[model samples]
Target chain A: MPLLDWARTQWDRALGALAVLIGAILLLVGWMKISDTGFVSEQLPYLASAGLGGVFLLGLGGMLWLSADLRDQWRELRGIRARLDATADLAE
Target chain B: MGILLGMARLHRKAGAAVCAVLGLAIVPLISADAQADATYAAVAEATGTRVILTNQSIPLNVAPQLQGPTASAVQNSLQQSDAYAAFPYPGEEVAGIPGVVGGAAGVPLPAYPFVIATSFGDGAKQLSYPGIELRAESTETLTQSTATGGSTGAGGTSSARVARDGDDVVAKAVTDLDALRIGESLVISGLHAVATASRDSAGKLTRASELSFTRLSAPGFVIGLTNGKFTLQNGTEAPAQNDVPLAQIAAALSGAGYPTTFQVPQETPDGIIGAGLQIQTTLPAPPAGTPGGFSGETPVTYTIGLLRAEVAYTVLPTTPAAADTGVDAGVDAATGVPGAPALPTTDLAGLPGTVPVLAPVAAPVAGIDLASLQASRAAVGSDVGWIYLMVAAVGLAAVGGCAVLYRGAR
Candidate 1:
């Protein structure tokens, strides 16, 4: 099955994963602000390049997660519609 | 009585005959011994030798007239040639003067290697240190500079003395000596062993020794005076632009080698100045034609550029005991040959008032030590720009890691 179809049946797992990831993001941001605040000015050139490189990597990962989450919802809704039609047929 | 007289006469006649025979027998042995000595003396005269140590030649007459063995039979006769004692001169008594004890004095008032000095104002009236020689692995004049201040009032104490800055100081020095064993290893052709060296009774170098070179890089800083203005040499007319900044000079020096920038700073009264050249450890070739003549010429080329030097210092006079108020510019006191053109001095004519100014050289970093551009990189301080950049990169990595984790959980 497509990964999106699989995620549709695993709502609890996806939400749990997202919560852990957000926590990690907050922790890393705090560490950077605390460890090297002066890095913003003194090494601006290097900091900008590194920041852009980091953002690209993160955006890619987030995009993959978002794509998988949407695909799962679509698969789950289709599965519900098919089951509902089968029930209606039994009723008739 | 007649019988006794006859017996005594007979004994005297017999004793006389025996003495005559003994004298004849000794004559041949004595003649043979004399013959042997004559032959050995001829051989020793032929074999004994002496060696030359300088421009002087050795006299060939010290061999003894006696000889024994043609080889080992001849006694080894050797003498120090005339060159051994010819280098006597009277000027070696002062400090830092180099040469044979009695030889012609080397360049006068010889300053030792690795020295640093700072001088300011007309006649170094503001401040100076006499002997601030710093002996280390290497030394160089990173910059020579001058700067002027806007005076608050004419003849006021503030306007009277030209405040000396470190950028106005000049210095140059050499750290290495090139020792050549060429002269020390005498090459001769007459002896059985070809060219051989002579050693003293203690088996040390008694004859010619290796040639060694002493490098003296003289960085010039003559103070000029005009009105109430003072400046280190900037080779220019404007007092405002006379100063050579130190930070820029240091960066250039630490990157290149010695710097040759002599910018005459403007003194209050005079605006223009011409700089004398300094070529230390100069090696002049035969000029493509002649064989020898230790003459002088402008062998090095002078370069110009804006000097930058960052001078970090404790107070010029931190302690009285540690201060050097008397400057013995050793050159003038030397005896034989004259010292280098009285190391460009400070002008006293326009020196404002009777301030009793002493141009004692303080440890001023010069910008004109550009004698060798090869070693400049090592002379400057360390740069830590890359380290700062790395720290910033790590900060960015944290941001990336956060994004990765957030996406993975989602």
Candidate 2:
């Protein structure tokens, strides 16, 4: 149960990090391809595909990371609600 | 059923992974080396005032003359028989073919056609080149010729003459202007520019370009340029521009009550209403070990008014580089020459060139001058600001994403 709880909380963050790392690597490779090539025509495909793909991965990683923050905020809101319910019961 | 349900839950991550892999794979596959779609050994072109223009673009190497079936037959006979052994006389011959009299020796060798000559000049009085007073002219003559050849003991000797205009290599282009009205307040006159190259008998290559103008004038203003020239010897490379003339032109404009702004030439999306001059000469290298041979195409171009020349060397798989939008980029209101400031004086002077402007000049209506009207119209021209702003927004979002991602990593 403890291991499951830890995995549940850290999964998004871990995946986000992996995605960011892969995206950065892709960007570096794309830049190297651009600088290594002689002709502008030869660089076009790599620029369009690798460049855009890296950007897409980076965006996805950022979104997933932000979602973790929102998930934590939601948990805090639930705790606050439960405490309010407990106070109301005690009053009753 | 359980596997399918699990796959559905992880579909987003699965899709992202597939896209990343596909994106990485596609780069190498699609970017395989493509052979050059087109190739040119040399190209030369020039333009000025739209009317005086010239282009001399010779395609890749070609044999000077064609050897059709007859020539081929002669070559075949020479190779097959003893035509190389003895000189064949007209009356007496007994060779490989039974009926053949003189053998291959009697057939006159093809004339060595080794010269290309092109010339252009404006003849009509049409207002094609507005600023030009004298007729625009451009000429290029290149010659590579062999005089005579004789076969001796299984080999042959031929005499070649590299005579460009007779053993000389020469390229010449000229565009001149008498007067031009850039805007309501500015008039330029007596402009002459020439791009020329010639090789002397001693094998010395000389390139000479000249630029001069009488004055840039308006109602109460006038300015003159010191002559501009660029001359070099025996080299394939030349300076990019005739900087002396350009600097003198700028100096003259600045002196004649105009702003001192020297702007680089750029391809403007919406063309400018102005006059410009450009001339280029490219000469091919002589064939190796051929004495007295001038081998190259000579092209001459002339223009007046506005001109645009674009030479794309390769067929790009994607769209070419972006041209200047001329939007939100500060430009002179009347002339549309970017970076040139608006003229302060509003005096509308009559065009004072040899070639007259026949159309009756339009008077300023409702107290608005032509320059101001031009500026207002330019303001309403296509705006590329939104596109740039969108790019900027995306850039900012990427920065924000980086910040968030960095913090999460930490």
Restricting to chain A, the TM-score for each candidate equals: 0.49, 0.85
Poorly placed runs, candidate 2 (over 4 Å): A1-8, B1-396, B399-410
DockQ for model 1?
A: 0.01
Candidate 2 TM-score to native? 0.25
TM-score of chain A of 2: 0.85
Model 1 scores a TM of 0.21
lDDT for position B242 in model 1: 60
Please write out the lDDT profile of model 2 over residues B74-156, one tens digit for every residue. 00000110001011111111122333433356754442222112122221111111211111112222211111112222111
lDDT of 2 at B40: 7
Instruction: Summarize candidate 1's per-residue lDDT along B302-380 as a digit string, tens digits.
Output: 2111111111111112223113312121222323211110112223324333112122111122222212211221121
| Best candidate (score: TM-score) | 2
Query: Worst 10-residue stretch by lDDT in candidate 1 chain B?
Result: B35-44
Tell how far residue B78 is off in model 2, in angstroms.
46
